[model samples]
Target: MPRSAREPGRATVQVTNHRLARLPDVQSQEVAPRTTPGSGPVVDVEQAEAALVEHYPRLVRLAYLVLPPGLGRTRRVLTAHALVQRALPRRRASASVIPAQAAGGTDGGGEDPGYSLLRLQVLRTALEAGRPPKRTAWPRRSQLPPLFPQVWGLKLFPRSGGAEELALDQQLSALSGPARAAYVLRGLERLPEDHVRKVLSAAGVTRPTAALREASRVPRQDALLESPEFDPCSLQARPTDLMRRRQHTKAALAAAGAAVVCGVLLAVPSGGWGPDGAAAPGYAQNPAARAALDPAKVTKVPPTAWRTSARTDFSVWPARGGLTGDTALLRRALAVWSRPGGSVQVSATPGTPSGAPAGPPQLLYAGRVDAARVVIFYDGLRLARYAEPARGTDGAALDFARVDAATGAEAEAVVLGRADGNVRYLTAPWVTKAAERDLLEPSAEAVDLGLQDGVTAPLAGPAEATGSCSSWNVLQLTEGSGIRLLTDLGELTPAHLTVGRPGAPGEASEPEALRTWSPFACSLAAVRSQGVRSVNAWEFARQTLPDGSGSAAWVCTRADTWRGDGPRVLAQFQTPGGRYGAVAAKAEGVTACGTKDPHVLAGVLWKSAEGRWYLLAAGSSDTGSIRATGGVTGSADGNLLAVRAAQGAQAGLKGTLEDGRTISGLR
Candidate 1:
C-alpha cells in the first residue's frame, strides 16, 4: 500500500526512517508517548532532556559574562545548571506536542489530528540544534538577548556605557520579589507577561500589587552609583534613556552634597570665639600670658574701693605752721587751695554713747603748697591729699591719696625737752590753709560709712594687752581678755586720751579718738593715734599675734583707706559701757581673729603687728582658731587656710632656719 494509506502509527515510523537516512549520525534518543490520549501528539522525552543537558554549559558561560566580575565562573555554571534542571520538567511535558504544533496549519480544527507525530519530532530537533551547547560557551559579542541588554552593552563598550549597566542591575535589585521575576522574564527574556506571572507564582512571589508600587517608587540611580560593577556610558540606550539617567544622577549628587555641608555646619561651635581665637571667661587675653598662666602661680583680682565709715576724719597740717585760729581766715585760705572747682562741706552727728546730732561738715582745712601739692583734711584723721605736678591749679583733675594707718608709719616725735615745751612740732607736710578751713567748718553730712549694729562705746584705763586691737564698735578679744572685759569694769584702757561729756568736769567735748594697738606689745611705736568727730566704727579686724617669742605675727586689716587732706583715720576702736583699761597683758605672744566688712576687705594685704603676712580674703566669716600644724587643715564657707611645718618639726615646736622645711596644707 502507499504511505498515505498506511496505519496512523505506522505513518510516524515512515517519516522518522526517511529523516534519519538523510541526516548525519548525530546522537539521538527515542521516547515513548504517555498514555494520556487526546492531550497532543506523542513526543520524544529522552531527546528533549538530552538537548537541555547539552546546552546548559554554554548558557552558564553567557550568564557569567553578563554578571559582575566578582561572581566566579564556577558560581555562574552552578546557577545555570540549576536553571536547566528546573526547565527540563516543563520541556519534557511539552515536547510531545511541540513538533506537531509547529507543523500544523492554522486552518486545522481541534477535532482533526493536528500534525503527524514524525513532524513534531522534526521541529524539536531543529530547536535543539539552534540552541546548541557551544552557543553559550562564550558570551555573545553581537546583539544581546533582550533580557539583559544593558549588561551586554556594558561588556561591549566598557568605559563609555558602564554606568548604564550599573543602572540596570540597580533596577533589578530595587524591584520587589514578584516584580523582579516578572520583569526578568517579560522585559528581559522576551517572555509574555502572563507567562512571566506564571513563573513568578511558581517561585512563590505572589504579591503583584505591592511589587508594582515599590518598583515605581524607589529610584535606581543611587543603587547604580554605589555598585562598583555598574557603568552608565557602556550601556546602550536611546537619547531619551540617557537623559533620564543623567537627571537621576544629578539629583542624587545634589542631595549627597547638601547632607555633607549640613553635617559640617553642625560640628562647629554655636557662639563666642572659636578654636584658635580669644578664650572664654577667666582666660588671659594675651596668648603668651595665657600660656604662662596654664600653670599659673598667682592670680590677682582688680582693686575695689568702698566708703567704709560714717563721720570720716582726716588730720591737717599747717601750710606755714602758725596760722590764725579765726574761722573766716581759715575759710578764705581753704577757698583758694580747694580743688579747682571743688568745695569742702562738713557736718557732725551725735557722738558715741549719746545720739546727739552734730553740726554739718565744715571747710576745716584746704590749701595748695608747692605747684604740685594740694591738701584737704576733714574732721581729724580723714584726709584727702592731691599731688599732680602736670596739672595746673585750675585744671579739672583728681589726684587722691589714702593714708592707711595700719600700713603707714607715724611721724617721728619732735623733742619737746630742748625746744618750747608747750609747743608740739608739726611733722610731715602740713595741710594748707585752705585744707584746715575746709575741714573745721560744718556743712551737710559728707560721708556715710554704712555702719551696722550700734555705735562703739568708750572704754577706760589700761591693763594687760593681748589679741587684736581695732576701732570698730565690737572688739574681738582673746578668750581670757573677753572674760575680763565682761567681769572687770576698770581693766579696759582707751588707746588715746579721753574726751568726756560737754558739761562734765575736765570735759572739752573733743573729737572722737582713733588708734591702733599691739596685742603682744612687740612695739608701741607702730600703733596709730588721732582724733576725729565721726568714725566708721564697723570695720572688720584680724590679728596674728606671736604665740611665743620665736613665733610669727599676722593680722587682717582693711584693704583700702580714706583719701583726704587732714590726718585720715583708717580705723578706730572704743570700749563698751562700764568697762575700763585694756583687758589683756602686754605679752610678747598673742593673737586675735575676727571678720571684716565684705566689700572693703575684698582685696587687701593683711600683716600682723607680730610680723606674719596674710592675704585678706573677701566674704570670710570670723573664726578664732589657728589651723593645727601637725593635723589636717580646715576652712569656713568663704575662706581657706593652709598650714606648713618645718622639716622634722613636731607639733607646736620651733625649728632652726636651715633645718626647717615647709609642709603646706590647705583649707
Candidate 2:
C-alpha cells in the first residue's frame, strides 16, 4: 500500500545548496526545482519504482546498516530487503519531499528525487524495526518480521570484514537507532552535516541534532562503510540443520498415517480414536542436542570445480583423500567433532568459535596421514580438523581455526600431520611445486619436496624444534602464477609469510625479501598456534651507529590472524655484526604496525663497543618527529633517535606522524 499525495508540479520552492550537494547523480538542469520544508520533486509511482529498481542494492545496504543488530544477521538481511521493496508509493502520483543533492555525494555519485523518497522511506522503517513493542499499542507493520521474502532451509548473511570494520560495527551497535542512521548517512551517503540533519528530520527522527552529535563520537572510517561486511546484497549462504529437517520429515509422515487411521475408525462406528488422559507430556527435541551424524548429508565439492571458479578462497577447495567415501569414518569424525570425549584433546585458535557445525560441512580431506586418520571440514567460516588413531577413536583431537575469506595463497596448504621431527602437508590441487627453505639462512637454496597426489613429502617442522632456535624452516608452494611461503605454527594450518611493507607485501622467494626475513625468522614462535593467516616483515628504518661502529636496521614484523582480531606486532633492532635481531618492543591486539596503521615507534638499550650505553629509538619512515619522555628525555627531527643513557634506563616514546596524528611506541 502506498501513501496518497497531491498531483505533480504543485510545489515551487528552491532547496539550499547544502541540500543540493547531497546527491551525487543530480544533473545541472536549465531550471532548478523548488521545495518547501518537507517537499521536493514530484515522484509518480512509475518514477519511484524505477528508482528503487536502479538502486535496490544500495537501499538494502543502507537499511541493513541502520537496522538494529539484535535482530540477528539472517533476519536483518530479510527485513532490509522487505523494507526496501515496500518503499514504493502506492498511489499513481506522490510528491517526494526529499530533494536530490549534488553529484559529489557519498553514494558513489547518483541522484534522483524518487531515490531520495525511497531512501527516506527505508530509513524510517529501519528505525522503526529497532524499537521495542509497547503494551498498549499494536506493533507497526515495519516492526514485525515480513512473511514474504523468506529463505527456506538456508541462512544468508554478509561476509565478514577486517578488524576496523568489525570495531566500527560494534561501535554502531552501541548507539541509538537515530544515531546509527546519522552515522550511516554521514559516512555512506557522504552528506554534509546540515544535509544529514535535514535528511534525518525528513525521515522522522525527532532529535536529529542530538543524533548527529552522538554519531560524531565514532572514528571517521568512511572507507570501511563500503566494505562487504555491511552489504547484505552480497551474501554468503549456508544450509540450516539437516538432522532436524530429516526428523521433521519423519514426523510429518507419522502424522499422515495417524490421520488415515482416524478416518477409518470414524467410518466404522466409533467417532474417532479414544483420547488418552494418561499420555505423557509432549515436547520437541532441541536442535542443539541432536547430533549431526548423517554421513550422506556431508557436503562434498567436485574435483575440478576450482579450475573455473571465480573465487580463489577455501570455498573452492575440492574434497580430497581416500576415505571420503567411507560413511563409518565420516560419521565418527562428525560425531566426535560435535561431542568430543574427555580424552579428546580440543584446541581452538583465539576468537574462533568451538561450537558444533551448523549443518553438513564441506569435506576438504578425509584420509590416513602417518599413523592417524585426519578429517578436515570447512563450514563457510572456520576449518575443523578431526584426528584419531587408525585403529580406534580413542585419544581423538579436534582443532578449529578461522579461515573466512582466505585467498588462494593463504589457503594454499594445511599441515596434515606431524610425526617425530617431521611434518606432512596437504597442498591445494592448483599447486605445481613444493619446497622447504631455511629462513635463517637467506643465501641457502630451497630443497624441493616432492608432491604425491596433492600431498607433500614430510619435512622437518619448526613447531617440533626446541632448545636454542638456530634454524627456521618454511614451506614454499608454487601455486599457478606466484609463489607463497607458509610456516608451521604448531597448528593444523600454517601461517603465510610475506615481506616488504604492510600494504605492498611480496613473496619471500626474492633475495632481498629472504634477507629481510633472516634476522627475525625466530620471531614466528611468538605467534604460533594463534591462527595466524599471514606475517609481514618490513625494514622501516636504518640508522648509523653514534659510536662509529656500523649501521643498524630497524624492522617491524606484524602477524595477522584469520580471526581479524588480536594481531601481533613486534619492533626489532638488528646490529650490523649480530647474527639475530633483538626485540626492541612488542604489543598484542594493536594495529600499530599493521596495514591500516603502518607507523610504529620503538626503543632499545644498546651497549657500544667502547663500553658506553645508549638509548636507541626509531619510528617508521612516516614519523615527523620522535620524543622520549618519562625516565629518559630526548627528541629527534626524523625517524631515528639515539641518546646517551644509563644501562637500566626506561622511557616512554611518542611519535608524530607527518599527517599530524600522534602515535605511541609499542611495548
Candidate 3:
C-alpha cells in the first residue's frame, strides 16, 4: 500500500472587512469566583465581541456542519448563534467553561482564543443537539447530517471498501459523544492532537482515534500514520466513573458492526450502510462505476437556473408565488421579457398547475400549503416562485422552482450566498414534497438526504424605499425567463430575466443557495428516504507541491467571500488498483418527483476484479422516497456512481464555489 498523496496547491487569499457598525454592548458585570484555575479575568465583553466579529461567520458555518441539515439552514444558523451566545463567557458559568479547557485555560492562556471559542461553541452545540429532546426518539446515525467534507481528509479516494472517506463519517456518527468531540476538535478543527485527547478524556473516550482508526482499518498507510506530533493534554479530572459505566454496557453493537466507546451506539447495521435504514449487503463492494461512464455520454449541464423553457400558456399562478404579490406585477414581469420577436402575456391564475386537483400540497410550501407564492406553467408542467421568511424583520430567502419539460417533474434549484453577498448554486433537484409526506425532516421511509453548503445570509431589500412597501418582498419567476423582485403589488424592478442564473454573486442579492439548499435537502431526503444513492466528494486547500503545480484554488469556492488560491474541489474515486477524479451526482440534475430513476446511482467509485477504477455518474430519473422494509430494499437501484472513469475527471475550474462543491457528486 502507498501513503495517500495529499499535495495541496497554492490557494489565493480573499480579504474582506465587515464594518460592525454596531456591536453588542460590552456592559460591565459582576463575576462569581471560580474553584479551578479555569477562572480568568472577567470575559472582556469587548474582546469577546471582537471574537464574534472575527470568528462569528466561521462559527455559523461550523454550526451548519455540526448540526442537522433537517433543521433547515436558517434555524441552524440561529441555533448556532444561540449556542455561541449561551456559551459566551459573559456570565460566571459561561466564563468558567470558557477558561476550563479553552486553548490554554489551565496554564492561564490559550494558543487560539477565537478558535478555542469556536471549538467549544460547536462541541456544546453538537452535544446539546445530539441529546434527544425530552423523550424524543433517539436520532439514528443515518439521520445525522453528514459531517463537513473537510473531516474526511479524502481527496482522490484514499482506498476502497469504505476505509478512505465514506467510512470515516459513518463511523464518527456512531461514536460516543465524547469521541465525536475529540474527532471534531482534533481533525476537523485541526486542533493539537494532545488537546483533542484531553477533551476526549472529559467525554470518556479512552482512545481518541479508536473509531476513526477502526473505521479505517487498513494497511500501514492509515489516518493514524498521517500525523504523529500530537500528545493528549493533561486533564485535572478524568472520567473514570463514566468509562466504568460504559464497560458495563454491551460490548458488541448487534445492530451496527462498530466498536462503541463508553456505550456509544451506532445508527447503522452490521452489514454495509445505505440510505434510509436498510442494510447495504454490498457495503464492502465497489462497482468501479467510474470506468463504465464515458465522458462523451456525460451531459454538459449547468447546476442552477431561474428560467423555464417549458412554456406556461396559463394566465393564472398559485402572493406566496412572486415578487409583487399582485396580479398587475405579472403583466410587468411579462413585459420585461417581451422582446422584438417574442411576446410575453401571462396573468395571475387562481388555481394550481392545469387544475391538478389543488386540494392541498402534500408538504406545506412555507408551513401553509394553501399557497402564497406565484406559479406559472402549462399542462402538467409547473414553476413555483415565492419568498421565504427572513431572519428577524429582515427577509433574506427566495425560492425558485420549475418543472422538467421532458419528465414533467418539478424541482427547485439550490443557491448558497457568499460572504460578498454573491450567490453560489448548490445541488439542483431539491424536493418540496413526495406524495403525502414531507422529507425535509427526519423520515424513516425517506432517504434522509443531507447537504452542507456552508454559508447563509438574510434576504435583500430595495436600495431606496419603494413607496414604503412592506419590509419583506416576494419574488417571481416566468417560464423561459429569470427571477424578478415584486417590490410593489404591481411592480417589478431591474427586470433582468435569466435563462439559468441566480442574479449576481455579491451583496444586495438573494442568498439563493441558502434558500435552495433547504428545499433541495428535502428533495434529497425524500429521494433517499427509501435510499437510492450516496457517494464520495472531496475539497483541497492551498499548498505548493514539490512538483510545479502552483495554480490558484478558488474554482470550487467563493473568491470574494471565501476565496482561496486553490481551495477548489475535484470529485473522484478509488479502485483496487488506483484512483481517479470526477464530479458529484447532484450536479447532473434530477427531478423532484415521479419514478424518474428507479435505480438512480451516480458518482459511486468502486473496484474491479482487475483492479481498475470506474467512474459513475447519475443516470436520468426522479422519484420520491419509497419506504423500504424487511422484505425488500432499493439500495440496489443504482443512482450511485461506479462507472465512467478516464474521461470523467472533473474539469478543474477557477471561481467562487457553492454548496454544490460539498454536495455529493453523481447522485
Candidate 4:
C-alpha cells in the first residue's frame, strides 16, 4: 500500500487558529502564578490600579497582540480593553519576577512591580480566553464576552495598514495562542527567549519551547508591532450596515403607528378581536407580530428578478404558484406560521426556530399540492411551510427549517409535498432539469422527472423508506454550470451532496464521485431532520492489510448543518473488493472532519478473512504518527496503523501532527 501522496499544506496553521478560537474558555482554573526564586515584591490593589490607569493604552495593545487574531478585530479590541480594565488584583499578590520590558519602546510602563503584575494578569486571562471551556466547570468572568464597554450601532477596528502590516497580521494569526504570546512578548515587550519562556510557562503554557519554535517561523518584524494596525487603543469607527439599520428603524415606526390604530379599532371593551383561524390569540400591543401576519405586507419579488439578480439564493427566488394572488390563502399561511393552533401539526428541523417572524416574510409559493393547499415562506434565516386540506383550514400543518446563507446548488430546490410514498420539489428558476436516481445503484441511469413551473415530478423519497434499506432515492438537479444531488431529510428542504476533499469539494456527478457515495448512501438516514446543508465525502487514506489479504480505504463523511453548530461525522472503512463500507467510528458536533479542521482520527477492530484479528486506525495525511492506547497499545509512523489484537477489542487512539501538537481520535 502506498502512503498518502498528498503533500502537507499551510492549511493546518489556519485550521489550528480556527479550532483555538472556538475552544471553550478555561473555567474554574486560575492562571498559575509565575513565582520568582525568592518571594517577589507584593503589589496592592491600589498600585495595580495605578499601573493600569497610567499605562492603560499600551497594556490594552499588549493584550490585544497576545490574544488570538481569529477573534476578529472588533472582538479582540473590546476583549483587550476588558481584560486590561480588570487586571487590577482583588487583593495583594506577588509581582512577576521577570523584569520590565526594554527601554526606548513606547509601550514600556515603568519598572513598577504593579505594572509587572498587571501585565501578567492580562496575559494570563487573554491566553485563558483562547482555551476551550471545560465541561465540568463554570466559565470564568474573562472567558465570557465583555458586556460593558460595548459601543452600540458601531463597529470599532484598528486603523488599516499597508501590505506589510497585513502580511504580518496573517502570519501572527496562524500561530497558536501561546506562540502568539511568545512572539508578542519578544517583539513588543523586548523580552529575550529565556524570559519569554518563563512568562509563557507562568501564564500556563504547557510547552513554551514548542510555542517559541512555532513563533520563530514568522519573520522578525518587531517594529511593525508598534504600527497603528496592531494598536487597539487607536481605533476607527464604522456604522454597522447603515441601510439595514435605517430600514429597521422605519419598520419599527410603521409598526408602532399601525399598532396604535389597530388597538383603537380592536378595543371592543367587552370581547377581544375576532378569532384568527388556527392561530393563537394575537396580542393587540405586539405591533411586530401583528404586522407580520398582514398578507399585503408579505414581500413578493418579480418573476424575472432571478435572471438579473447578483445574489444567488432564496432572496432572489420569485414567488410562484396558482394562488400567489390569493390573499385569503396567504393570510391563513401567515397566521398559522405565527401561532399554529393545537389542532395544527407543527414540525421544525433541529436548531431551527419556530417562533413568529420578526418582519413580513417573502412569499415563495402559494397554491395546491395534491389534496392540500400549501404555501412556502422565507424570512432571510428560515424557510417555513404551511399546508392544509384543500377543502378547508382543517388539519393544517406547519414546518420550519433553517436555511441561512444558502447559495448555489444548496438553495437550488425545496420540498413541496410528500404523499403516497413519493415527494415533489419546487426548484429554483435556474434549474434546467430534474431527475431521480437510486444511490445504492451508482451505475443506474437517472430517470428524468418533468418540471412544470419549476416543480419537479413526484419521485420516491428516501426519507419515507422503512423496513429493508435496499434502495435509497436522491433527487438530482441540473443547472447551466453542473448537476447536484439533494436527498430528502424528512424536512421541508433537501440536503445537498458533494464529493471531494474538504473546502474544495466538487459535484458528486462524476462516475468516481458517484461510486464513492454508493457504499455509504444509507448512512444519510442518520442525519434526518438535522437541518443539513450539505454532506461531503473525502477519502483520506489507503492502508495495506498486514496479513496480505488486501488494501482498504479510509474515508470520512461530514454532514454540515445550516445552523453551523452540529455536524455529523462518520469514519468508514472499505476493503478493496467490498460492496459497502463499514462504519468504523462516528461522532456529532465535533470540529474534526470539518472544513475548518480537516484532520480526523478513527480506529476499528477488524477480523481478517483468515480468522486473525487486528486493531487498525488512520488519520489525515498530515498526521506524523499514531499511537493506540487502552485495550490495545501500539505505535506506528505515518497516519496508518495495523496492530494484531483480539476480536471486538477496544482501544483509544491519539495522533501527533508533524507539528508537536497531539489530537485525540474521534469517538
Candidate 5:
C-alpha cells in the first residue's frame, strides 16, 4: 500500500525502521526528530534511546498508578519508551535555542555551539517517553468481561453510536491547518488546550491561529471517555445471578404452597384444651375459641386499676360530717398527722387545793412542759354578794339589811362589809311606781356581742376553755345572715374561697382554700377502684366572689391535679372573663384497699385565663411499687407515670389537662 500523504501544513517526520513505519503517522513524526542527526543540531540518537530505556520502568509505574490497570504492563513500558524517544529531539532543539539566543546577544553567532545538545536530547527523550498513552476507540465487546453486561458501561465511547460518531470525525476534518492540529492533539491525546499549545510551542509547532482554530474544531470527547474505572474481577465475583434466582425461587414456593400450609395448620388441633389436656374443647370448630387460642392474636393486657400511696399523715375528709372530740385534742392529734417527724407530751401539777403554798417544800408540775401553756384550772378565787331588802331598826337612817341563811329572813342590820370590800351601791329617786319596779331589779339578760374594735375576748364554756382547741381560733359567730364558723382545718375542703364585699375596706379576697388549710383537699372525681379499667368524670361547684371591682361573679369547678402518678383532684373556677382557674391535689398517703403503697402517678395542672391556657404545677406521689422492678422511668412534666408491667416490661398512663395539656400514668 502506498503511504498516505502527510496532512498539508502539518509537521511530518520520516521514519527508517519498519516497526516505526507500521505505527501511526503521528508516532512516526514524533520519533523522527530524534533519529535525524545534524539536520538542525547534531542529535545523539543512541544516548536518547538509552535514556528512554533507563526511565521506562519508572514511567510504567507512574502510568499504572494513574491509568486503568487493564492496560498491560509490557505495553505500557514500550509505549513510554517510544514516546520518550520521540520527544527528546524537540526538547534538545528548544534548549539549544536558548544558548543560541545568548550567543546572538553577544555577537550574533551563526549557531550556538557551547550547549550540550546531547544532554538536552536525553532529557527530552525521558519526558516524551514517560508521557501518558493516547485514548483509543471502544474495545470490542468480546474484550470485555462478562460481569460488564452493558458495552457502554465502561463509558469509553460516545453514546451517539456509530453513525453520529462518523459525523463528528467529518466535522473535524474540514477545519483549517492549526485548527486541525489543535483538534487532533486535544481529541486524540486528550491534552487540555493550554497543554497542547505548550507542547506544540516546545516542539517549534508555532502557528497560533491554526492551533486555536483546530482546537475549536475538535469535538468534545469527554462524554465518550468518562468511563467508570471498573474491575472485571470484582464484577465476576458478585452473586447477582444467584441472588436473583434465589429470590425468584422463594417467591414461587411461597405462591405455590401458601394455601396448603394455611389449610393444614387451620385443620389441625391446636392442643390448647380439654379435660385430659389433649386438645382445646372448641379448638378450630368455634371461631371465638379459636381466636382466643391463636398465638398470633395475643396482645398486652392493660392494667385495670392503678393504686398508689405515700407515707403522709394528712387525710382529706369528705364534706358531710362535723368533727367530734375535744377541740384541742383534735387539733393536736391532727397537727402532727401529716408531719413526717413530731412528738407529743402531757403533764399535771400536784398542789394545794386553793393555791400553791408559799414554802420551800412545794413540788413542781410533773413531766416536761416546754412549748406548752396552761389552759384551765378548777378552783375559784373571787366572789360577789348582793344587798338584802329590809328596813333598819334606827328611824333616822333606813336600815341596811342582810339576809340570814339559817332563818331565810330579811332583817334590819348594819352592813358589816361587801364581799372582797369592793361593792358600792347608790340609790336613785323614782319619779313613778313603774320606775321603782324597774329600779328594784335590773333585767338579767346580757347581749351576745363582738368587740367592734377587733380585740378578741376569751370564750366561756368547757369545750372553748379546754381540750381540742385549734392553734388558730375557730370562731362560731351567729349573726343576722346565719350561723357560720371559720377554722384553719380541712380535708376534702373547698378548693377556693372568696370574702369581702366589693368597694369596701379590705374588699375582695380570693384565697386558695386547699393550700391555706392544714389538711389538703381531696376529690372523688376520677377515683380509681380495684380491677376497674375505666376512668370516670365527676363535677362539683364552688362559689366565689369577684375581684376588687366586685362587678363580676365567679364560679369554679374542680380542675385537675398536679401529680402525674398519684390520685389527682382537680377543680375549675370561672372568672368574670369567662376563663377558669384550676387547682389539683396529689394525696400522698393513699392506696387501694388491698394493696400497700401502690405507686400513684403524678398529675398535671392546667389553668385557662382569657381563653389562653397554661400549665401551672406538676404533682407527684411516691408509691413504692417500682422497688420490685429493676428500672425506673419518669416524665419531665411529672405527669407521665411509669411502672414495670413485668420483667423488663414497662407501662405508662397519661391524663389530659385543659388546653390540650395531659397528665398520664395515675397508677
Candidate 6:
C-alpha cells in the first residue's frame, strides 16, 4: 500500500550528543563514519531519524493492530511512536542493531537483530502503561472510545457507518490485557515464542500461551476483521485494499451523515397517515414506510415507525445480583433509544455492590444497524468497592470512560435506596446549545432519589389525560441539580411541562428543590410478578405513542418468559378513568427473551402543538427484533411512558418542508 508519511517531531537532545563510539552494536551499521565536529563519537542522529520517519506510519498501523484498538488514529499513532521512541535513544547511543531493512529503508524482515530489543522495550512499556494502579494514558481509549466523529452513534454505513471496524475493535478489546498483548506481539509482530514469553514475563503474566489462546477466542459475529495467525508473513491481504475501503467509505460517510448525531434531539412532525401507513402529506417516499420496505433500515426513522425492545442481554455484573446494573442499563437505553421526543434520567455509576462477587459486567452494545444507537455502555464496569461517601458532593467524581473494568481495584459505591434496596435514578443537567456541542456532551453528574418520587398514577391515552390527572415523580437531571424531583402530577412544574397549568411551581417558582416532595418508588416488587426471583426498580410514567396515542412506558429489567414473571416493560394506554392495559405480555414458548419488541411505545417520536399532532416511539433493539410472537408489530403499544426531560433544550424548535409535514430539531 502507498502510505502517507507522518511528519517527525524533533527531540530536544541533539543527535551530536549520542556517543556512537562507546556502544558496540550500532558501530557496525553504516553511519556517516564520522561524528559531529566537536562531539567525540555518536551514531549519525539525522540518519537514524530518517529510518524512524520512514516506518512511523507502518509502526502505527502495527500498534493499532496490537494495542487495545479503540483510540482514534492520532492517539494510536502516538502510542506506536512511543515504541519507536524507546528504541530511538538506544540507536543513538550505539547500543541498537541496525534494521535489516534500514540500509535500504525497506522492511526486510528477520534481518535486523535490534528489532527484537526495540519491540521488547516497546512491549514492556506498553504492558506497564496498559496495566492498573496508575492513571496512565494507555487505557483511556479502551475505557472511552475517542468521542470524535471517528466513532459516534452507529452511523457505521449505508456506506456511511462502517461499524465493521468498530465491532472488530470492540471484540479485540474484550480480551484480557495479557491476552491482548500476547496476541499483538506474537500474532501481529511475528515474534518468536521465546521472545513473546519475555514480553509476557515482563508484563507479569504467568501464562503466555493461555493469554494468546484467550484472545484468539474473541467472538466473530458481525465483526469483519479476521483473527491474525501465529505468523503474519503467511497472511495474504494488502494494506492498500483496506485503506481503499476506508477511503471509499469516507465519501459515503460524509454524504449520508444526515441522521442527526447522537444526543442531538431532532423530530419529524406527525402528519395524517394514509391507509398504507404512509404520511398523509408525504415526500417522494414516505420515510416511515421504509420500516415496512426494509425492516432493518433505521436511519432517519419516520415519525410513524415505532420500535421498542426489552433486550435481555447477559447480566453477569448487575447489582443486587442484577438490579442495579439493569436499572442503569435501562436508564441508558431510555436516554439513547427514546430520545428526539422523550425523557430519560441517566444516573450511571459502575461498581460492585456491598456483597456482590465483583463489579458490573463490561457491556458494549455497539449495534450493526445503528452504530450510533449505543443503548448500553458499561465500559467503566471495572470499578472496585465503595469506599467513598454514599450521599454527598465530596467524593471523587465517577468518569464513565476512565474507570477500570476490573473488580477489586478501586471499589465503586452502589448507591441503592434504603426504602427498597433498589437502584436510585439520578439526573444530569445541561443546556442544548447545539447538535455537535452541548447536545452530544455527556450528563454532568449524578443525583440522588427523593421521597415522593415513588408515588404513581398511570396515565391514560387522551391528549389531556396523559401526564396530568395523575401523581408521579420525575427523575430530574439538570446542569444545576444532582438529584431528581419526586413530585405529584401537578408537581412536574418545569416551563414546558407546566405550560398548560399556569399556577404550577417551576425553576422560577422555587430554588433547586428537585429532591423535595419526590416520592420514592424503591420497591422492586412494584413491577415484579410471581415467578421471577428478582426485579429491578421501576416507575410508572406517562408518555405519548407513535400513533399519537397517550400511554406509559414501563422501564424495568428483563422478564421471565416461562413464568412471565419479571416486571412488564410495556403497558397499553386507555381512555380516561380506565387502567392502562398491558400491551406486551410475556408468554412461554412464544415470547422470545433474546429480542426486544420494537413496536412497544416508550418515548415520543414527535410532539407538535404547532400542528396539534404528536407521535410516540420506543427504542428498537438491534438484537433480533423481528421475532415477535404476534408477527413483530405493536407488541409494546402502551407499556412505556415517555416523559419530557426537565433539563436540556428549554424549548422545541421547528421548520417546514415544502410538503405539509414539519421538521423538528434541537436548538
Highest TM-score model number: 4
Higher lDDT: candidate 4 or 6? 4
| Model 2 weakest lDDT span, ten residues long | 11-20
Off by over 4 Å in 2: 1-292, 463-467
What is residue 246's positional error in candidate 3, in angstroms?
50
In angstroms, give how far residue 183 of model 3 lies from its true place. 1.5
Query: Which residue pairs come into collision in candidate 4?
Result: 23-132, 24-131, 24-132, 24-133, 25-133
Per-residue lDDT over 1-667 for candidate 1, one digit per residue giving the tens place of the 0 to 100 score: 0010112221011110101111111111111111233344323445455554544343232232233333332332333333334344422242233221122222212122222222222222222322324664764322122232223111232232376755565565554444543343333233344443443443345564455445445443422332334322222322335666788889989999999998667545444222211111222344543332221211211112112322112222222212223333333223222312342222111111111112122222232322323323222222322222324333322222223341101211111111111111122221111011011112311121121111111222122222222211111111111110011111011121112111121111112212222221112212222112112222233322222212211222211112221322111111111011111101111111112212111111222223332222221233222223222223323222323222112222111112233211110
Ranking by TM-score: 4, 2, 6, 3, 1, 5
Can you write out model 3's per-residue Cα lDDT over 101-193, one digit (the tens) per residue? 344322223544544554464555555575556556776432344342212211211122334444544544455555455554544444465
The lDDT of model 5 is 0.25
lDDT scores for all predictions? 0.25, 0.77, 0.27, 0.80, 0.25, 0.29
Pairwise TM-score winner, candidates 1 and 5: 1
lDDT per residue, candidate 5, 175-294, as tens digits?
A: 543454455345433445665565455434557546666557455763332222111111112223566677888898998799788766665576533221111122334555434333
Residue-by-residue lDDT tens digits, candidate 2, 547-657: 686788888899998878888987777776555566666778888778787888877655566656566778889899988776567899988888886645556678898
Comparing 2 with 4 on TM-score, the higher-scoring candidate is 4
| TM-score for each predicted model, relative to the true structure | 0.17, 0.56, 0.21, 0.59, 0.15, 0.22
Lowest-sum lDDT 10-residue window in model 3: 554-563
Candidate 3: global Cα-lDDT? Answer: 0.27
Candidate 4 Cα misplacement greater than 4 A, ranges: 1-275, 283-288, 463-468
lDDT of 2 at 60: 95
Candidate 4: tens digits of C-alpha lDDT, residues 170-233: 9988889999999999998888899889888888899999999999999999899999998998
- Model 2 earns a TM-score of 0.56
RMSD of 3: 30.2
